[model samples]
Target: MPRYDYRCRACGTNFEVSRPMSEASAPASCPDGHDDTVKLLSTVAVTGAARGGAPAPPPAGGGGCCGGGCCG
Candidate 1:
């Protein structure tokens, strides 16, 4: 449960909350009942896979730049 993005500086409300993580710095109230909220610093765009799958094979290079085989 981790989703927090609040911005309510008295009247500029913008909210999104999915609590947890120790309240994430507890203190959020902005449904037009401003509590002087400000905790909007969110940027999460994670998409991938990693779990003993296939991604660990690039460590012995010698051709300059990855295509390593002797530059021309």
Candidate 2:
């Protein structure tokens, strides 16, 4: 089931509903007993290097001047 976002036009309420994709077009009633509602365009934000977020963790193991390749 996917989550849907809705805003009650009658009471100005913001809410969400989880239902099958087939029912995505179905009407939704707000918890405030309002039948008039409209689906909202939700926004999702992801945090990572792609989104200019914090850097990734360093890799495990040890390294030297030549990366421990020629010295040892």
Candidate 3:
């Protein structure tokens, strides 16, 4: 199962739920009971390296005394 994020248009609430990918886009209601909810695209954070995309910003102080040149 994959986790999905949903937002309620009627009540302006946000929440996350884990469900099958086939049902990820189905109509989901707000936990508060509102029926006019919409699903939102998901996002994630990368820690050390980029996951098939552009590289992430170097940590504060440039990663170490070597100034991030070691990986290159």
Q: Model 3, range 1-72, lDDT digits (tens) per residue?
A: 788889999889998878898886677778998988778877887466577777877687568657676755
Give per-residue CA lDDT, model 2, range 1-72, as digits (tens): 789999999999999999999999999999999999999987887666733576765444445555556667
2 or 3, greater by lDDT: 2
- Alpha carbon deviation, residue 40, candidate 1 (Å): 6.0
**Pick by lDDT: which candidate is best?**
2
lDDT of 1 by residue, 1-72 (tens): 998999998788799889999989998898778788899889989755556776545557643565677564
lDDT of each: 0.81, 0.85, 0.80
What is the C-alpha local distance difference test score of candidate 2?
Answer: 0.85
Among all candidates shown, the one with the greatest TM-score: 2
Better of 1 and 2 by lDDT: 2
Instruction: Mark the regions of model 3 whose C-alpha exceeds 4 Å error after superposition.
Output: 46-72
RMSD after Cα superposition, model 1: 9.5
Query: Candidate 3 — worst ten consecutive residues by lDDT sum?
Result: 63-72
How do the candidates rank by lDDT, highest first? 2, 1, 3
The 10-residue segment with the lowest total lDDT in model 2? 57-66
Worst 10 residues of 1 by lDDT: 55-64
Better of 1 and 2 by TM-score: 2
